[model samples]
Target: MSGKDTGHGTQRLALPGVFTAEQAAVTAAAIAGIQRADGAIPWFRGHHLDPWDHIEAAMALDAAGDHRRAAAAYHWLARHQLPDGSWYAAYADGDATRPTDRGKETNFCAYVAAGVLHHYLATGDEEFRERMWPVVYAAVEFVLELQREGGEIGWRRDPDGSACDGALLTGCSSIHQALRCALALAELRDDPQPDWELATGRLGHALRHHPECFLDKSSYSMDWYYPVLAGALRGAAGRARIEDRWPEFVVEGLGVRCVSTNPWVTGGESAELALALWAVGDSERAARVLRWIGHLRAPDGLYWTGYVYADEAIWPRERTAWTAGSVLLAVAALTGDEATGAVFGGAGLPRGLEAEECCDRS
Candidate 1:
């Protein structure tokens, strides 16, 4: 099936031995059903809502032909934004007013730019762009303030309002992608943000050249692959990085491990690794990964977060919207969805001034 839904921008989002267009639609509908009346998507029905995963689920909805629900998710972020342009890390799903976690994570705040750009590219909705521009602008500005002298972004601002000390490689790499998306939107509106462009270039430099600037969470697969997945690292360099660590994090018949030391294989990490694999032009391996993780798909159309292969069980014993969201994104990338490729493929996004070209503010 071409996944030619009656909606705009539909395409063949199916992968052989993985999921069909009809099955993809069922998954999308299940995610839409998870949305609260106000459009915030939590981890699941009883779970807490975080800004980043909320947007991930929203982007998946767009991929699967549910743009209305995706737009609603973005609107919810706009409504919940604090005065300083950040959102509290976790909100109680049952009651939006109750914040379960008070820290403001820079990466989580910056992700709205990527999500907004993806939605706009998928739907080409002018009014939606106009409505979300301020949201994107403010959120990007909020995250940029956390950038360090070395170009790595500070991880979070605490509940007491002070910036956290060290930077995370995974988080900074993710911000690197978000900045590109933000700069793309800036150019689209005929309003170029030179500062953002410089920031993007600097962050890319940091991710590529200065791994020491970030805290060494080398045990986690995210820190290993996010640089490639987020577009900071590519070409032969990206391929080598992935190949070097393939043995440590991958479980052959299972998927990518959340941590090298754990016997657990996770859906989200595996799906994200597949996206990174696609980014590096290793589509065959990427498709293999997507197929490998299909065993985690539950009958409800949501994927179980991960399987503890050693224990023969799914730990955390939970299903998450982000896992489902990531799987769909990987499928969209594999199926050659135009918007998915545009955002994740790094061909059309503006590369900011290299770190040498810009005056250092940090």
Candidate 2:
């Protein structure tokens, strides 16, 4: 065997705490086990599927070496996309039925861009990218239409085409990231977006300086870290923001709460916080965040949605496929693991603007 192989050998690395390689293998096996023959991955064993969770499951499949299954999931998305280039918010289990209208959530629709980009990276299929471009383009246009006068984006649009009540910093931040990915994909395919740079800059500026325009959601974890996470805040300002809210949202050994006053900590928020920390180059604290959720992993490798306050065993034990996927993506980023290079190693901040321009626009 090569020297590199000799050093690392074939020993399976343990996840957090008690999870051995054997356990991880079983967890991965279980995820695959839940995947339907047509490529739909249900959130849990025998449960129904939703678009957001389905895409998340597909990502996990890629991480676990089930590219074929992942591709099938993408194909599923492609087949069901609305004429406006969005997927329904939720779908029935196993089969695509009982579609629920989530009223055009920008983040929900934007998420597909990242997944399609990731799938293309994983498979290197030019045809797949070609097929997805029109969907991606139309979706971006749909989100752009929701941008308000002051540069902040509305959270969603109602089914009748009316705007949702207010803006969410977190939702907009996620959409900002997705927009960048969409633009990157556009560039990669030699179909650069004409106004993408300006639109992204406007959104970033609004997030950094125009907090008054958005709803007063400072207590929420998404509001706390999203600016930095979205690449809208950077350098000294980003660092300061995280430091200011660290104690309020972070719950020591349990991870981060979705909101400071809620006293409920969730795996998704914790993992996402780790992601924000990673974006700002704080790998040490990022690792700590990951370790917090690492302690919460079930024997099946899935993660419970949230943990209850004042008691460890009283936590909500329902596993979410997105929670596990977020944790995996965070861990990969923290460790600089090349196997997950595409997902974790994207350009740190959104390109095409200076930090001053991004943060100081009036």
Q: Each model's TM-score?
A: 0.96, 0.86
- TM-score, cand. 1 vs. native: 0.96
The residue pairs that clash in candidate 1, if any, are none
Backbone clashes for every candidate come to 0, 1
**1-362: candidate 2 lDDT, tens digit per residue:** 00121112112324455245555455555666677777777676556676666776676565554566667877777777778776665655657665655466777777677777776765677887788888788888878888887777888778787888788888777777777778778888877675776677677777888888788988888899877776667678988999998989999988999878887899888987887888778978887777877666777777888887766553675786777767765655554543344444456323545336656664
Model 1 stretches with alpha carbons more than 4 Å out = 1-11, 359-362
Candidate 2 Cα outliers beyond 4 Å, as residue runs? 1-22, 45-50, 338-345, 348-362
TM-score quality measure for candidate 2: 0.86
lDDT of each: 0.88, 0.70
Largest TM-score belongs to which candidate? 1
> What's the lDDT of the predicted structure labeled candidate 1?
0.88
